[model samples]
Target: MRPAHVIAAAGAVIASLSLLSACGKDDAAGGKSGAIAVTATDSSCEVGAKSGAAGATTFKVTNKGSQVNELEILAPDGKIVSERENIGPGTGAEITVSLSAGTYKVLCSAGMTGRGPSQTFTVTGKGKATDPRLDAAVASYRIYIGEQVDDTLAKTKKFAASVKKGDMAGAKAEFAPSRFGWEAIEPVAESFGDIDPKVDTREADLEKNQKWTGWHQIEKALWKTGSLKGEGPYADDLVNEIGILKQRVGTASITATSMANGAKELLDEVATGKITGEEDTFSHTDLSDFKANVDGAQKAFELLKPVVQERDAALTSDLTDEFAKVQKLLTKYEKGDGYVSYDTVGKSQRKELSDEVNALAEPLSKLAGVVAK
Candidate 1:
């Protein structure tokens, strides 16, 4: 007979593995039990295994194309069973779910907007109990979160420097790439909370005003060189704008530091491969750690938002709304489709949103004078 300790250790390992499998899949290279590969282009869903045994199963989703995307596994009852967000370009995740012997749907979304397609699959036998591989993936993902935070801070600093130089062209060039850095790590942002109340109260006036807008106006004013007959005054305004931005950058730095330190602890565990024992048990501990760090970071951002808004309420509000719209557009693909293809939402709509936000910055710049008093 097996030694009692060995048998007990085996049981523990099995249980731990079972727990991890339920969390989600983390790779596209298909697992031993089976695999499903999905390509999200123009918003469509593809399933790897149309039929399988019930119990625990993993779906490996890949964005085999350009565009940011996400995948969701939904029960037949329209309930979301599992999801992975901000999967990024050319990357994928394995999502595991439990199913009774029946049918299920895989949903996909392209980009942030709520647009995409879904596919369904059927399960035949009562599924096998959860597997160990799933747990290992979850533990590994906890480590991925730390790398994301480091990348985000690095990109943010670069963006801030571009803005400081009054290099609008360079600033614009850095925008999308920098935004991707944040997007990759955003899942962790939820771990943090809202901006500081001290800052929130200061910006309440602008937040309440739906009409306030931000970046559009600044872009127009800065870009319209031919029409800028009053270029000298406009340049002065740009100088003031940059000064306010510097303050915002300072606030962002504080928020980043808090998140980075928190993420480092979790990343160290995964990077060092220190996780051992039953897979499920290890994953539970890993996930809990991930959430704690994420929550800490979320609180930091929540506290920071108000400070950012206070720098120029009108401008900040406008920027806030634009960011909201863009984010909303991206959330659409949070589940079903993994590839996001950008269709013009129309230059006019984009302009309207941008212009409104940019206008707020002007009045916001004036706040520097008021606060100095």
Candidate 2:
């Protein structure tokens, strides 16, 4: 979800990520405990360690830069292995990822745009074994994401067929429903860097001379022109890209901690884009997207609840209540199946939604640490 217009909300929307752990805990830091230290500035990304044993490793990411920044570990093929975004100046966050023996790139994106700085890191030997319950959680999540992908692909194909047939009203009607699955499992789709930019890039996020193709490109044509003229090619491209996404899902590498972090990232998606009315700009179907994102986050939490409950039942209980609160608030605006147009939502109501998201995000941010423990 790259949109130039939405950066203004970064400070407020993403500040919760800074509290990934409790106060005064360096156990997650790079210093004596084998965790990697990553110090980021506008001009540099300094990683304290060059190599480590392969297993679950934590990266203590600190943003020393003047602007808000993000840290990411990418595979050799350029897919994001793990990431922590919207780290404000002088704040810190931790990301715990399961690493296999291989070479990886630790990259930092200053101001959350363009690649800022990166370095090579290596892992040797299969480090440590994983818990059986953690393994089960990962397995269950994969099945869930596969189901979402199947649903998305089916709906997108139907929407594409409508456009190809020049059925303008039919295409418009099918548009928002087509995107529900993609929005739900977005973290997986976004892991494959090349596929997301092609499949979901908004027009404002289009780079110079880059030919835009994806949901938003077609979204613009459908809502603005009220016609599907010259849109057949883009619709075909959407189907093809989603097909790539389906294949990639089978090979996705995910740790238990990553699933928790991804749930937090989905809430960030809501605060930054959906709640701010930046996601479904023309269609005004932001609430539908909001519900999908929350549902996805809830699914991830539910799968991991076994481990979390064993460790910290209180946190688990708090998360369940917070998620239900947000979902219940959304229910008020429900139309027939989807939500009412976003423009119809007034300022006071929007504030209520934002407040509920913030409440959920605080407890949600601690999920990664609890699950990793």
Candidate 3:
């Protein structure tokens, strides 16, 4: 979170993450052992070894930089394999990732600047096959994804019935909590390709001539225009597409790395959408979505915490403390079971919230790397 002019929500986020991880041979991706040590300073990234086998390589990173720095593993396609963000000077962190046989870049930046030096590491051997334990964990996560879809579908159906009955007040009341189920599983929801945008597209994200037909579209009609007439079809289409997602996610495979990165990404979602007040602009229910996104991300981290603690107890403790701080800060905005409207949050308050979220996110960014098989 950087200081901006603090304008009103742009009312849109650029949402095309069309391209979007591993621990073991039996771990998350495939398994091998050997740490690729890295030293970072203001000027350079030094990787200890230039080449190794393709699975379970740990990057033991020491930030000798003049200030805090970040280290990232970029895949050949440029997607982040994993990363460690905001590491303070004289501090060190380890990121273990399962790698396939290929060339990859180990990049680092001092003071969080864009410009940085990088070292190339080559994986010379094949990845090991998946371990049964990793297989079961992935299976369990898929089951959890399925459960959320079921819950979301149930909530959205009730929401749909309210819309179809032309009960604007009832539909408005259901808006925040109903969206919770969807937000809680957004990491997985986002994977169904077109379904996520279709289900939640804000009017700002609509194509030049494309019609809007999701929650935000209906939100505009309900809260801005104060009408739900002719909105039933949007409701129907939303739930039907969710059903499609449910069926698809049931057979989908999830990995430990995905869950960890998804957790980090979810918090990023809050930092971008909620802290900035760019979501639910008309209904001002951004706070509810904000909470739901944190819930989803935290759930994923909680699942991987056991493994993280096994690797680094100190980092786990830091994460625990930061998460509690963020949760406590968010609780202040609650008025019983609901939150105050987003419009009521002033710029300074938003800055405070943004700072707490960034605090949480900095420690959280290390999670995916630590848990890599």
Summing lDDT over every window of 10 consecutive residues in candidate 2, give the lowest-scoring window: 16-25
Backbone clash pairs for candidate 3 read 22-98, 23-372, 23-373, 24-28, 24-30, 24-31, 25-30, 25-31, 26-131
- Model 3 over residues 13-73: C-alpha lDDT tens digits? 2111110111223222222435666888878999888888866777777777666566777
Ranking the candidates on lDDT from highest down gives 2, 3, 1
Comparing 1 and 2 on lDDT, the stronger one: 2
- How far off is residue 138 in model 3, in Å? 3.4
Instruction: Please report the TM-score between candidate 3 and the true structure.
Output: 0.70
Measured by TM-score, the strongest candidate is 2
CA shift of 121, model 3, Å? 15
RMSD of each: 23.9, 2.4, 9.1
Please write out the lDDT profile of model 1 over residues 126-245, one tens digit for every residue: 544433433343344444455555554455456545655666666544433433333334323322212111111111123334332222222333344313233333334333333343
Model 1 CA lDDT for position 225: 36
Using lDDT as the yardstick, the better of models 2 and 3 is 2
For 40-128, candidate 2 gives per-residue lDDT tens digits of 88889999889888877788877777877778888766777878776767777777777789999999888676466898999899766
Candidate lDDT scores, in order, read 0.39, 0.83, 0.71
